[model samples]
Target: MNPTDAPFVPGVPAEHQPATGSAPGTPLALYFHHVHPDVRHYTALTPREFAEGMERVLAEFDPYRPDDLLAPSGPVRPDRPTVLVTFDDGYRDNLVHARPILRELGVRAVFFVCTGLLGQHSGQPREDYLTWDACDRLAEDGHLIAAHTRTHPHLDRLPPEQAQDEARASLADIAARYGPGPARLFAYPYGGIPAEPGLPGDVLAFGTVRSPAEPWHSAPQAIRRTYLPSGATGTWDGLVRHWRAQWQPAGATARPDDRDDLRGERP
Candidate 1:
């Protein structure tokens, strides 16, 4: 079916839609960047706002950890409202602000870090990203630490060989520091997926497609993800509308409506 014919949810990038053949109860993963009290960027969420939003989600859905959803030993329930929480770009706020809240809420999230940036300080407030020690601490706290690229770059804009090195190097970096388990998972910098799709080696990669991922979906390389907006009131409103669209009656057909919930945030 044409993706356009599928449901359109506000705040969600409509480039990818739920497929009819998708596995039942496939997870909807939400990606966040910064969770600082002072919102430096549009995608950053304040501490209070992040807590409240997560609480609301917990009320309606079951948390899907990497083990349960990514590489499950048991079969996933077809009717479960399963969701995975993910944070991109390793930031100190994730450990200081986001981690405590998530721990309190009993939700474990996946953190994708740029291997090269770990332990490097720029002396900028709220920009002194996570160190390797912090990443180890995060893992100790039961959260998964994955690779995001050696240095966050637009792989699409680089030569194929350089791009391949960037991707592979990061995975190797994480394995050397973190371990092989975490190294298996990777996310493209800026959610940019190359034409070839998945990375060269055995890795489950993610992209910013704003849709739920199926267990054995055809596009395994580009696992779709939705952004959890934490900017202005309008962005939150769009997120709420998208949540409603996602949880509508199973058989309900959505009216054809086209509105960009994350319009201004993107160039």
Candidate 2:
């Protein structure tokens, strides 16, 4: 079936429409980190507004965690488009304003949190970050809790040893707080870190800035994401356009004969 003609999957939302003119095998993914009534002004959404947005999302897309949706999980399917929702910074607005909406929609997401920022003054008035109890509640609700490092530092700028420490310690803290299971996901601060050579085995997925060309071929750890802004042009239609543009071919599709050459010894 043509990419555009593919029927929308049940439980997946419409705002995640595939790119116009895309063919089968084209890779596509959608991402969102924050959702507020007005992001230009960095304000939280009112309960009613949040409810409306969730209702819209629930009608169209399957919200997934990075590991389950991305990675060496095989080639992309045009009809079965997968959208992953992620929230960075573990803000209280997530627990206060976003969680209820997500729960209402029955969509699960991953929250990348800075453990060090947890019980400290938020610098912003009104308890901006999520409390430990709130984080626990989110996890209990089936949302994945992942790391954004301990202090939200720029790991790329840090000394190599310090960077390693940050990565390890942050994962440790997240495991401790959320219970000792495998910790698989991570998000870099400000999208600054490169994929390291020897990350801990527990880490499964990491996030990076979205690149349209080669959208799905980044470092195994570097999953790409599009930022969702809130505004007049930032309506649900705007979100669909942004995702569609990213689905455009980064380069010519591989010819069937080239598959062997591309595989080489990688497999």
Candidate 3:
């Protein structure tokens, strides 16, 4: 049988459910970064490993297109559960291994890139990062390409002016190369955020910490994310354990209608 057709085990709830009498539409968002099979070592995968990982994800959640979440005027569905897949650091492994699997599964995801790091020769031990041409292809294939800062700087540690520069410069770089502008979506390097009091309002920032039970919080432009690491036991019991530990409240049903708002909210 195909791995994609494997049965999924339901995980425990990851967030807080609404009060019994409360109205529906409570938001719940789950975010994922890299999706490799073997993360014990940061090595690129052979084609077979990538295929297995893609099968695991498709069996679990509904992957969404970046544009669908950023659309300005659409009747957002409030009941569907949304899982946003994101790749950090412009890894070439994403284009080589992850992209093809995603295409086979018909999943759409977002790729957060560091412009200065692309096309540069890196001695980082892993040739898993993406190339400029690969990035262009992913974008052309309808995947969302957003900013991860100019050089992957930790925004929280920088001075106010420097933080703003990092944020703006990354955005500008993406716009110059990819087209009009990165949709309001932005991911902070090392999951960092600005401490500056007057940060720009144009972009939306997504953080690294996230859960499944509650919807993400709104900001001038900020959203929280759940990290799905590689090597997580892909069993039904394992998934349930992760979900319950991460987001689900006791005795609560997740409403599908709430998922629309959850996805649209920043991050």
Top candidate, metric lDDT: 1
Runs in model 1 with CA error above 4 Å?
A: 1-24, 69-79, 197-201, 210-216, 233-249, 252-267
Tens-place lDDT digits, model 3, residues 141-216: 8888888887887788888888878777878777777754464567877656666723345555666542122233
Where does candidate 2 have its weakest 10-residue lDDT segment?
A: 257-266
After superposing candidate 3 on the true structure, give the runs of residues whose Cα lies further than 4 Å from its correct spot.
Answer: 1-54, 73-78, 123-128, 197-199, 210-214, 234-237, 240-267
Candidate 1 residue-wise lDDT, 1-267, digit = tens: 222234343543445332221233345677878888775663578888888877766666678766543342222332445567888889888888999999999888899998888877765634579998898898898898898987899987888888888888888888887677777788888767776543744466777654244443445557777654544444444353344345434565533342212111212
| Estimated TM-score for each candidate | 0.77, 0.67, 0.70
Better of 1 and 2 by lDDT: 1
- How do the candidates rank by TM-score, highest first? 1, 3, 2
> Which has the higher lDDT value, candidate number 2 or candidate number 3?
3
Clash list (residue pairs), candidate 2? 12-60, 12-61, 13-60, 13-61, 14-60, 184-204
Residue pairs that clash (backbone atoms under 3 angstroms), model 1: none
Give the better candidate number (1 or 3) by lDDT. Answer: 1
Top candidate (TM-score): 1
